[model samples]
Target: MTDIEKKEQYAPYISISRDEWKTLNGALNFSLSDEDISKLNALNEPLNLAEIQEVYFPLSHLLNIHIDFAKKLYEAENGYLNSGRKRSPFIIGIAGSVAAGKSTTARVLQKVLSLWPEKPRVALVTTDGFLYPNKVLEQRSIMNRKGFPESYDTKRLINFLADVKAGKEHLEVPIYSHLEYDIIPNRVQEIHNPDVVIVEGINVLQVNLSEKHQGPQVFVSDFFDYSIYVHANEKNLLEWYISRFKQLQRTAFQNPSSYFHRYATLSEQEAIAIAANIWDLINKPNLIKNILPTRFRANLILEKGSHHFVKGVKLRKV
Candidate 1:
């Protein structure tokens, strides 16, 4: 075990090794094929069937347990109160650093959970859509801090979550285009009362103190029925971030409409330098200042190794 894992092996959580956690799968049949995994993987990240069976199958099983219990609890409460209250969607929040494979995790979980026998309707949403448009960021003079908490329209995000938790139907969420590096105006993704909602973002777990005094502070995580933090060492995170940037330079960045089109012509060394600079200046600072601090607040933590594979799992004790 790493020193960090040793330190975290205390109350409120039970730290389990990867081998041990895989046993918790309890003979659950995994139906996802290799092609499905390839499609679900994020750029430059490798996710295979073994990883899904060993890591995510157990995770999906655990989430199923939680979902079942939550439903029972809601039903019991309604019976006692004699109020016909509809059960709200189970919201799962996933928070991690840039290029930490959070998107893949969310997508895989969404797929696995939706495949259950009951076939729950799973909806996936990223907090990127909650980010203020590029124009707003430039106007606010914080375009450099694009992934930071201040870059998000926190009030709107909170309201959206509130509505989702209230069992509101046919809600429209703003769509963010990574290629264009901005919110697409007049475009929205409609979410209609999903059974499970997976919210992924770098700052989903973040809580800003400045917003507290404004009123009853409702953080983005307030509505999450469960939360996950994808953890990795800074070395691995930096390497993965640069690798993804390089891959995007060859692919998405080459497009004329891409916000990073200028980077498409950069040499190998030039791309590395630029990626490192952006990581150091923007992503790293935000990770340390905002994202990393909220790691322990998560109900579950998936610790990753240098190769982006989950090495261990820390689940919060109920």
Candidate 2:
């Protein structure tokens, strides 16, 4: 590539093509069973051995290297201060548009990171738990604006991260159920003594944690040891979103107790219409305004092509 082309391609980052990324996987020794993929992948998503070998293994190894470097930094800082400090859970924020596969990436990394020689325990948490409950959104007259930044309890979420960073154990975070389509009342998830915490959500990379954020002020991203933003074309995301909606209609939505059960039996055309409307109104707006704007903040980015195959990996320049 010419210098101008190379500069344009990798400005602000060092970009690697899929073929180049694949070669880095040679030293990775790991495999996932079919059952693991079924449990971790999103509805209507496809994840095969080739995808793991070509994309995730190298990615996992890179994260491991980062984690090691962070440990050394922590020790050095403590030494300089002449104080003894406990190692806190390494926090990783995974951000992307809905149906962009951030959840699957977070889960896969959690599993692979656990298997590293360090045997570090990993905990995965979705910021959906930090979303305002349905009643709160309804009262605020933003039920239609659910995925927007204003739809979340930003202060509480920031406090939760603060606690986690302070080395607190057995912290209780609310549980959100996709099946129920809301936060489960009184159902809590405990984060206890994890070596790593993966926080995934549509707004994980929000440049500002709160509306009142001012110059040189603290933001939620301040707590992340590493952040990744998954990227794909807008057309691909819409297709994936609608496709997953159909899959859920056949599965989760069919359950009598599911909040979306009403849409389960709709005809294909009807289902498509509703899904498209939702994308146009809610998901897409939030992506353009809140999520996509934060993409430049991530330490690494995984760019996907058709069928959710990662075609490029960009590591931010130091």
Candidate 3:
């Protein structure tokens, strides 16, 4: 290939500094209020509001467009038939490697999107809830590979989305507890037909990847009206994972009931080593073998730099 082609190929992962970020988002009209900025700043670490404006404002705008499109599609399909029935929830899928900040992205998106005038009552559901119960994982001898695609109750997840998409009222979902690392028995979170539902996890876009795999017919992503993947290089992601793990160890691990409490007593060096090992052995391999390959399938991509700030975005070509 020519140099130009090679450059173009490598350009998808390009970085944008905080200065350029402002320029990128300058055309977007959305801005966080002083209260919103204060809440975001009150996070464990400081963040630049200008950087957020550059990154997430455009994202929120795109989501607004996606919501509009979904509404139009719903109307066209039902309005023509003269039906006055309510439509189902608009589903969005968010997929990324562990410690890539997809969870944070989902939460931030939920907060921002819920503020919109047209689409209110947004709900966020995680595929983490669809994970097989810890008992089941232990019984199957696959406890170590908890985030793999096969570890999820894919059928139940699909059915849940299908029910929500069909405008089913009062749909219940099993709640998973991170502290206990198990599904709470006889408990469910009720979904009351919201305007948007975002399903996020490490393998949200992953299917069997082939017909011969004989896994299952319906994948969780098939129900999504839009999908997003947070992108970053493996090296940056490994560093980010280590940092998050250390923070979690200092905080969440202090809880008596946390599944990761055993790691709380480790020295700083020891903790870093353990976190690096987990990333190398589990997360990095999974990203290379499964998650990263699916980046091309996303409807849009949020590419971030080392500081966990989004630098650029790539939308799939029409």
Candidate 4:
């Protein structure tokens, strides 16, 4: 069955074709140049001004409407409680398989949302920073399962989200280096007060149950005011993963400091083989076992075609 047909089985979501979705782009006066799109595009992913107009433009507008409603809800609750309370940042969680273009979606949203007439302060954070250090993974003997849920510092990530929702200021987030393939030693990213926060990762919408828990459990999605999932078929995802791996081998892997520097010397066929193996052994299993199960949990879903272009959008009915 097709992706849209599969989605039709779920009554909670209203799926719309790309052509239909583009018509919802109301008079909100905004435009992004090709230069801007080039900066926002992820490695090997294609994003153009037309895609932005058809997809992201309406998405951003919808988010702004949600944000406005959220502000009003805060005010109403404060009044009902008869207490002076400050509004907290609206957290947005973006989750999907690796190489599904989620990073590009987050970056584009951050840029587009920041450009709104209100000019709200927008902050972007990836859960990669919350990943357990390579040393920790090695010690646990799960180094090969780097992207698995257990490899993440879930407690720390939950705490960070809690603090951000509590209006904490000058929060420090650990930095993860993709080139080094590990968390940085001491460097950190500081997040100040922002109107919106975009948390992007492979496992943002994931839920883990613990037998040791007594009361209620606090999940990462609990802190998100809105959530999005980027979706593509397994075949397309594998192809994109291998393509990105080959591009990295030509670029980042060539750096002497890169953790995968050995891959830089590999021939084209050898690199393709390695990439396919990694995807099969690591990424594909993770997607089926953990990530794909959480797709329906998202408030919005961006379905992509084989070319890395969004072909349809599914929004959860209120």
The TM-scores, one per candidate, come to: 0.96, 0.94, 0.87, 0.96
Which parts of model 3 are misplaced by more than 4 Å?
1-48, 210-216
Model 4, 192-301: lDDT tens digits are 88889999999999997769889988899999999999999999999999999999999999999999999999999999999999998999999999999999999999
Q: For every candidate structure, what is the RMSD over all alpha carbons to the true structure, in angstroms?
A: 2.5, 1.9, 3.5, 2.7
- Model 1 lDDT per residue over 1-318, tens place: 888777776568888999999999868896887788888988899888999999999999999899999999999999999999788999999999998999999999998898898999999999999999999999999999999999999999989999898999778899999999999999999998799999999999998788348656678998999999999999999999999999999999999999999999999999999999999999999999999999999999999999999999999998
lDDT (Cα atoms) of all candidates against the true structure: 0.93, 0.87, 0.79, 0.93
How many backbone clashes does every candidate have? 0, 0, 0, 0
lDDT of 3 by residue, 90-169 (tens): 88899999877787778777877886766487788888888999999999998887887778898888888888888887
Cα deviation of 252 in candidate 1 (Å)?
A: 0.9
- Model 2, 209-240: lDDT tens per residue? 45666656656788999999999989999999
lDDT of 2 at 317: 82
**Local error of candidate 2 at 280, Å?**
0.6
Clashes of 3: 0
